[model samples]
Target: MKKTYDVIIIGSGGAGMIAAITARKQGKKVLLLEKLPTLGAKLKATGGGKCNLTNTLSSEDFMKSFGKNGRFMSTAINMLNKDDLREFFLSIGVQTDTKDGFRIFPVTHNSSTIIKALEAELNRLEVEILCDTKVERLLFDGESITGVQTQNEKFNSSNVIVATGGLGFPMLGANGDGYEFAKELGHKVTDLYPAMLPIYVKETWVANCTADTIAKAIIRVDLKKAKKLKAVGDLIFTSKGLRGPVILDFSREITPLLEQYEQVPLLINMVKGKNEDEVLQHIKKQTALNPDANVVEIVSTLLPTSVSKELCLIVGAILDKKFKDQSGQVRNDLVKIIVNTPFTVTESIGFKKAMITRGGVTLKEIDPNTMQSKLIKGLYFCGEVMDLDGPCGGYNLQWSFSSGNLAGHLL
Candidate 1:
């Protein structure tokens, strides 16, 4: 005889595990399926294994970070915000710390600690788990979920929650299975893009500045339509191009635009938001104090020695000449470059290098309140499978837990 579960949760990532736990707690028989031999493969690699679980942002501010589509998370976040997530972890015998007073992580500072706790909780609740099981397709009638078909066997359940996540980090078991399931069931899957990854730029000069980390750098898209798209954080120059916190966050916005344009032009404020006038004023002040300082020396006061030299070279400024000896046009151009350096983003590192994916199942097809499919009964979606994605810190993980919690209710 085939046994029937009250609910079947696909993929054992953070969302799937939390959904299984939540359903089992409701006294419903639950089944968690994972494609890999081990569960939480991607979760185990979050924050480079440090596991940023959640952040301290309030609900309103937190939602705003995700941009316009953020409102889709209202119900889920309300159900289990950062505070609730912390309490839930505490109850599960895992202590979390916000070392920076914002982003939360297990006190042990290991992603294994989080994965082990989640695994233990699922075990304690007696939720059936099946690793090395890849769901081939969802089994459903015309209007409702009947079960799921896996590679080796068929699972029986009226309710199914798809938490298969997005197609980022394929080596970590991300294969876009959830999007396929949603599409197979007549749901719309938006165009997908690789996000939160490093980018390659056209200018080879960035290679010369690889050794320096520019603090408080602001990167903005030079496109007229995307004039408001910008990010602020520490920036790093990679051998190929740009990376670090600023580029990672800004990549999400740029990836979509990349599909439309061959190369995206960028204006990088390397001097910590200093305008041309401000940079010129600083240079004039420095020149007044030391009348004999060369152009590189005067510019180095505002930026690293290497970056200053590069900017000076870009403007054709005589590196060994005093600031007053340089042509007025050369001086102005150097100041402009110092304030707003330009670069062209040629390409991204792609999904294999991306930390998360942009775009998933469109939000309108699923109800945020329950994470259940609006077009199909007994079907739910959670985690990166949905359209919502946020910047670094703890936004994405918290959304996974919250949406999973909402979907687990089986309401």
Candidate 2:
């Protein structure tokens, strides 16, 4: 006799767990498989151990934050919604609150608390959890997915949910196993690229200041044949280049150009106070304030010291003489320096360093409403496996939970 379930969910990340629990709540037998020794490895790493669970804003506000695929996700989000998620979390005993940006966090501010609450619920419901088990392939009969085959065993089921995450944080068991499973069912997958990844700037001083003092800097970018994009937030200084809240928030568009051009120029808008003309005026004032103040000192006033000195070197040729003796034209040129600081891009980090992959199972094959496959029966796809990706600040988790809830509760 073969063991069968009403639903078989692959992967034990946030989406997988949520799906399994939802199915169990619906009075369906559920089985969840995890490749790692324990569940929620990726969840544990989220929010730097705080677990930025969900946003409190309207579903429209939340959905729009997901980048291009935002509209496609609106369906699932509308069904499950953030308010429902909050209620679900509170019922499970993971009380929550939010910071200034309305980014929700576990009230306890500990990720493990949310994990434990979830684990307890799954325990009470008796959802079977298999750990240290790698699902190697998807098993199907004709066009319908029937079960899954592991390295040492197999499980059959009428319904199977592919919740395996994309190629981010592989050490936490986020390998692209779901992609292979989806392909086995004859679903075409889009080319996968890393989103919410860090950028590698050519200049060292920019990298350092981006890491330390001026960790948060707004960026204005002009890409090839694309509209100008601006990002305002904190960016970090990485050993390779830059990584932080802000840079990672908008990294998806950048890394690709870096690959194609090998030197994608970026404009960093450092001085926040004034427009370009006004900036030049400020520079003039700084020059007259102290003819003795070197270019370095004047720049350090407007920008962080480390980054200011670095920019001085890039435009050093313009003001060859001492600041005290420099001409008015040089002062104007100095003002131009703050308005535009361009750096060539080298290469974006690889998948192992990505926060979430940009592409996965193409959205067209699946009904975004039910999260069910239009090509095949008894097969469903959700989570980062879809061709959808979101920026940081709890958007990815929101997508994961909404999709999981819809897939689990749907007929």
Candidate 3:
């Protein structure tokens, strides 16, 4: 059977929804296809359900968050800049607010609210959405994308937007199908691996002390070229090592080291921004002022009680056995431990457990301006489907919005 549409958008994610809405706004008949039973599966899971729709940082600061590919993302960011997003959300009735560090969330504080708002907007625009339907193949004419073949049937469209996300959580319906689709269309995909994942450490003490512990710490690492690097944020303990915003960010920087050294020794600073000499002097003075106090009690005042006790046992042996017994050297050593406790990042938690798939279809193969393919006309890529990945902020979601919006505008 023959099929027709002014625009066909694959992947009912944030990008897909935004693109569909944009295309519809352009007076184009639009349809969105999804393999999942519902739309916005990953969006529902983002920001722990609060859905950090987009960050509030300036375009310059926003561009810096992408790490290695910050400059390469200029096209998408320039197209759907932060102001565009704030306006879009307000238009869709999602009151947005920004917190510390420019992280933005809905005033309703619920991802469901964000999704519902988008769904309502899409509905109002009369965009057709198809869920639980998979696109079997892309029909291309070497010059442009003509249509797509789905499980139930075939369809034709003048414009096609491939906003399908990457392969992160299979349970959430991210099955690397987007990569397959891109490859099928003769796009070059980089080596796919999981990024923004938890770090696996070999330290038993970290595993035991950190288990179920809501740890807020900074990691200090000596980079190969960047010298000392530190990332500060809340960290979570896993059976193997650590996971959280800080750890995940730092882990990506040391992935190369992990691949080479099998384990990269990291310094976990439960207290960040404090220098070693300052910490030592503080500890020395505290110990001098309260020499008679029990060692655990004295140390507990300086650190988390449990962690302090464990550290006391590790460093206290150099001093006399008595609780309050400690020499200047030992006190200084204790401070050093606190200031720079080193741990190794062995390997990331692997792709299946990653928050978002790291690599995807190379951005060079796709036109940065319109998100259209350099090789395949009428085919556009957006969101995690491209090699573009960003830090833990709202940058990822913003990329989706911008890329989709770019495609929509181009359509």
Q: Which candidate gets the maximum lDDT versus the true structure?
A: 1
Looking at candidate 1, what is the lDDT of residue 69? 92
Question: What's the TM-score of every candidate structure?
Answer: 0.98, 0.92, 0.90
Clash pairs for candidate 1: none
- Ten consecutive residues with minimal summed lDDT in candidate 2? 316-325
lDDT of 2 by residue, 307-327 (tens): 766776666533345554556
Candidate 1 lDDT trough over 10 residues, lowest sum: 331-340
For model 3, which pairs clash? Answer: 264-344, 266-343
The residue-by-residue lDDT of candidate 1 on 310-404, one tens digit each, is 88899999999998899999988887888789999999999998888999999998988899999999999999998989998888999999999
- How many Å off is the CA of 171 in candidate 1? 0.6
* Candidate 1 segments exceeding 4 Å error: none
- Residue 363 alpha-carbon offset, candidate 2, angstroms: 0.9
Model 3: residues with Cα > 4 Å off, grouped in runs: 99-101, 207-216, 220-230, 254-261, 316-324, 327-333
- Number of the top candidate by TM-score? 1
lDDT of 1 at 114: 88
